[model samples]
Target: MGRAPCCDKANVKKGPWSPEEDAKLKSYIDQYGTGGNWIALPQKIGLKRCGKSCRLRWLNYLRPNIKHGGFSEEEDNIICSLYISIGSRWSIIAAQLPGRTDNDIKNYWNTRLKKKLLGRRKQQQQLHPATTVEHDHHHHQDHQQSPTSTSNGLSNSALERLQLHMKLQTLNQNPLLHNMLWPKLHPFQEKLLLQAMNDENSNNNIMQLPLLPQPIMMESPLSNIGNMMNNNNINVSSYGGAFQLGGGDFMMGNLDNGTTSSLVWWSNEFETNDVNYDRSGSFSSSSNDSSWDCALRSSDDAGLF
Candidate 1:
């Protein structure tokens, strides 16, 4: 069935409201007020305009006490804090800020403040603590150090002597091997070694080797090897080795360590099939289409989500 028209079309006043009509509405409203009833407002105000038109005029342009300008730093901070806590509840945020509309605050936050805060956070996290500490320590020790000694715990002179000793030791032990290995190792390997040493110094376990699974031939073979690998603190290297042994065609999957039966089934299925599956790409496309359809349905139901 077709829907009815909004209002009776025969005698309805259309187009721009004249100054005379506006003045009459304004005068009547001044005397008795709009009383928040747009439907009855035009009748009370003695105007030939619809209630909806009057409401739109007052809200969009004629409303008093509205603030229209760039936001201050304090307002920016308040908006940021509110956004983090409440997400996109702009109406609640607008209520907290006097003279500010929800629409204005939303636009400002999305277009300006969000990007600036993210950039500042990234910059702060990139500063190197080791370089900063060393520079400060050197400045402090320069004033307090004597000719023969230094104030720092591991003094500059002592560090230099230890470095020279280490160099001499390196020359004495397999000099060619040391040079070749040191130069050949990637920076990532050096960083890993440093991290491992730090963990050891702090009395924490540093995993150096990969754990690979052994093939066990049982009558039922109901147990899941992936679950066992996860329950134990197995490393990625071990995972790679296990992957190779299980037949290099199985796609990497994450299963609960406790669900041994499921894991075993999955591994067995993959081994038997040995088929290349690009399921992720298809799944993503389907999800996107579903989301778009949901959004369209929501829009049809209401003006907002």
Candidate 2:
């Protein structure tokens, strides 16, 4: 068997409640209370309304000091905060605001507050437009595999990867991105440094070569990367709270106070050992067989290891 309807839909007066009906409901509830039965309360008040309707009308409207509108700033903050935390649980949110009802808060949010927030977002977007880059591979004309060129032959994706590697090197050097106020080592200089650090076979040869000049006041690597991407019709964006380079294949730690919490490297076409970089420029891997060990330091600091 199914549960019975609360009231006869045909018999109950629906839509907006009248002033006379409101007065009757309020006066009866005030003098004698609901008598603990809203279903029978309508019968006592002689009103052609459903029990649920009577309860809502009393609790949301006719109740003492039921605030109608003109929601204050403090109320708005509470509503927004609760909405963020508990979502659209209006009754629970309303419990925090003494004079407000769930219906009022919900209606206000849907009608006015939602649009207001969206308008502010639109304004912010207009002021500082978000960067969204899309790479299409069908446009590549040739295939050439080299240190600088992949099978795609300098495609947008390859360029993105190069830029990502460059960004990683930049972060590995400073970990502060542009905030360090330090000059960036050139791409050639970075390559030389990497070779000098990683190439064990050429350690004697590298030692004989003249040392690279210390980096001086130059453009920030971040700014340089941005310009490069913009010129190539691509842009950099943060991914999952981490500073991502290019299409997010390489992600660095959060740029918080010149300190990196973590770094992760990913490749779309190759399987490589996952590496983690910390603020100290030390690298570690989860794989046991991996022997990758490198430490990148700033020019002003000790030499790279």
Candidate 3:
């Protein structure tokens, strides 16, 4: 069975409470309060209004300090933030703002706040169209330059670096750089590069290296390793027979003579020099491709080469 109505529909007044009605509701509530019963309060006041209508009038309008419209910047921010988090729980949102009603916030959000945000967004798009376009262009470039793309099976950056290395005559002279660049190259790939080096008929010094694993292309260049370590505040030095830093046992490499520090090599600048051929018929160049150029070798280490 349906529930009975709280008040007689025929006798009750509805919509837009008059000034007299507002005064009566406010005056009675201020003096005696709703007497813990809203359904009986309208009858005591003799307002001819429903209990719900009287309650709404008292709480939303007739109540002192009940704010309506003209929300402040702080209130707007609070409303927007709460809306994003809680989503249309206007009663909870209303609780956060001292004098604002749930209905007022809901109406303002629907009619004004939403449109205001949308208009501001549109203005931004119009003002900075190039920014959006540039972002999309960068995204497209990243997608195109992915590792899957073909350039001897290398990513765009790696391929560019490789091409740059190929142009330098120094690369043909040093085999150590090749080993460093491709630390784990397969035997077949090594054979192909060796064959290319031996080919006398090859017009240009540039040799096509086989498709290597992505890690080979991504290894940090030796020149930048010092800078990277310095940025992270890593101070490498031999302490207690172990190459360590900041009291932590890092175990980077073997110590030189147990006393000589590797900090000189780690901290030194790797400056490039002009390319030159060695006297032993092997073309050697004092550049980044030649690791021997940077190494501080003594007469005792001559036979190790």
Leading candidate by TM-score: 2
Q: In terms of TM-score, how similar is model 1 to the real structure? A: 0.31
Model 2 residue runs over 4 Å out of place are: 1-3, 120-305
Tell me how candidate 1 scores on lDDT: 0.38
lDDT of 1 by residue, 101-176 (tens): 7777766665566544433323422552221111122344534422331222222222222222223234444322
After superposition, the stretches of candidate 1 with alpha carbons farther than 4 Å from their true spots are: 1-28, 43-53, 110-305
Model 2: lDDT of residue 261: 24
lDDT of 3 by residue, 93-138 (tens): 7776779888889888766664443233245347633211111113
Query: What is candidate 2's TM-score against the reference?
Result: 0.41
Please report, as a residue range, the 10-residue window in candidate 2 with the lowest summed lDDT. 130-139
Model 2: per-residue Cα lDDT over 1-305, one tens digit each: 98989988888999999999999999998899999999888877789999999999999999998899998766665565334323455886677677889999988876666444333434533643431011222224312211332222232233333333333344444322233233344443355434432342222433222112222222222224334335544434654453334542332322222443212222222122342323344333333332222224243331221
What is the lDDT, from 0 to 100, of the residue 190 in candidate 3?
Answer: 39
* C-alpha-based local distance difference test score of model 2: 0.48
